[model samples]
Target: EPEVTQTPSHQVTQMGQEVILRCVPISNHLYFYWYRQILGQKVEFLVSFYNNEISEKSEIFDDQFSVERPDGSNFTLKIRSTKLEDSAMYFCASSGGLVVFQETQYFGPGTRLLVL
Candidate 1:
């Protein structure tokens, strides 16, 4: 079965630097989303995209953050300016259908981002 994949399972960066996290969503999936979780916090939705435009976004998705489908299979998240508070487990998910039971977002293990 196809699965989502993320690169550099962990990332370390200096504050104020640009960081791009890479993800390869499941093949044939149409919807994509990005979420983050602080060490002990709930998973928070950042943004969801479909048809090349953002479908929905949470308040956490500020100007410093942006997402792109650079290619047919690759989805990327870029943080223009990293902050210490931005550190968290970033997850990439994709789904082929709309119904929650029939098509649930498949998540990657995660990319742990750390800023210091």
Candidate 2:
């Protein structure tokens, strides 16, 4: 089965630096999302994009964050200004439709971001 894949399994950045994480979502999937887990915290949604625009976004997706489908097969999340609190495991997921019913999201292992 085709699965989502993230690059640079781990990343370390200085506080206030910019960071961009990359992912390749499952082929044939129509929706994409970004979620983060701060150590022991629960997974939180950051944003969701479909049809070339943002569909839903959480408060956590503040001014410092942005996302793009830079190419046909690549999706990326960029943090313009990283913070120490930004250190976490960022997971990329894709779903075919809204999850209110049977839509299931497939997740990549994750890209661990560490800010110092």
Candidate 3:
């Protein structure tokens, strides 16, 4: 089975700076998701995309965040401005089932983001 992969395994950014995290999901997957986990906290859902449109998003996915499929295979998340609170491990995932919520999700290793 194919798996999701992410780039720039670790990142350090200044507060108020922009950052873009990239991912390549399983080629056949139809649903892609972004999640984050802050230190000592549970994983938090950020957004989901399907058919090139946003299917769902959490409250934390405010105006500063954006998702895109720039080409056929790459999916990306951009933070317009980072904050101290935004530091975390960001995960990229993909689900291939017809009903996404019920399918098994394949997750990437994750990108660790730090704000200073």
Candidate 4:
């Protein structure tokens, strides 16, 4: 029974400050992704990474954002500058199956961020 886990279940930050969300997924999974859900808004895709490189990213993943696999065991999403609009729940997911067939992504418990 493997699972994806996130750290700092919650975070509070000032506008314009930097923030990093962290996650660790099942050991054998290959693909990883980041998504966010703004309060009262639908979940939005931010980025996807594989083979030590980014595979896909949404428009929301702009110059202010970056993703990394620092030690081959943890994945992180860093926001260079926070904004009021950036307050939301961030999720991390991993899939062992291939994307061509719509593999199921196992999601971590979200990290809730609040910006003031």
Candidate 5:
């Protein structure tokens, strides 16, 4: 079995700085996504990518945020400018198929971002 992995499990940065969260999804998966959860809050979808382009995204994925798969196996999320309110646990996920039953997304442990 394979699994998604994230790097730098935790990160701290000053407001206005740029940050990049990295993830490696299970081999052979086709869809990739990013989601965030504030402490005590429900997980919120950020963006979804497939076929090398953005398939869908939420309002939260404003100009300040971007995502890329620089390498076929690694996906990354970049925040242009960090804000105190942007602090949250970011998760990277991937799904191999879209069937109702197999469309489940497997998530990485998460990368905690703290902005000051």
Candidate 6:
């Protein structure tokens, strides 16, 4: 399986600032997702996109968060405003398909964001 890859392995930003995280999902993937894991928390889903639109999103993905597919192979996650609690490792993932109810997703190395 092709792996998802994220850019800017680490980032430090001030509270209230905006950050755009870049990702390249698997070439043939039909599903994309963004997830975050705070310092000591379990991974939490932020949003899922399919067919050029968001299919599902968690409460954590409020107005402050947005996702976009700018081209055939790139997907991005933008944080409109950063907060202290937003510090975490953001991971981009891609799954082959959704036909079987569940698909194995591969995650990127993750982009670590630190809000100060």
Best-performing candidate as measured by TM-score: 3
lDDT of 1: 0.94
Comparison by TM-score, 3 against 6, better one: 3
Instruction: Candidate 4: give its CA RMSD in angstroms.
Output: 1.0
Residue range 1-116, candidate 6, lDDT tens digits: 46789998999999999999999999999999999999889999999999999999999999999999999999999999999999999999998865825788899999999999
Residue-wise lDDT of candidate 5 within 1-116, one digit each (tens)?
A: 78899987999999999999999998888999999999999999999999899999999999999999999899999999999999999999999865624688999999999999
In model 2, the worst 10-residue window by lDDT is 94-103
Clashes of each: 0, 0, 0, 0, 0, 0
What C-alpha lDDT, on a 0 to 100 scale, does residue 116 get in candidate 1?
99
Give candidate 5's total backbone clashes: 0
Residue pairs whose backbone atoms clash in candidate 5: none
Q: What's the C-alpha lDDT at position 56 in model 6? A: 96
lDDT of 3 by residue, 1-116 (tens): 57799998999999999999999999989999999999999999999999999999999999999999999999999999999999999999998979766899889999999999
What's the TM for model 3?
Answer: 0.97
Considering every candidate listed, which one attains the maximal lDDT? 3
Comparing 1 with 4 on TM-score, the higher-scoring candidate is 4
- TM-scores, one per candidate: 0.95, 0.95, 0.97, 0.96, 0.96, 0.96
Off by over 4 Å in 3: none
Off by over 4 Å in 6: 98-100
TM-score of 4: 0.96
lDDT for each residue of candidate 4 in 22-114, tens digit (9 for 90 to 100) = 999778899999999998999999999999999999999999999999997999999999999999999999999665348889999999999
User: How far does residue 26 in candidate 6 sit from its true spot (Å)?
Assistant: 0.5
Tell me model 4's lDDT, rounded to 2 decimals: 0.94
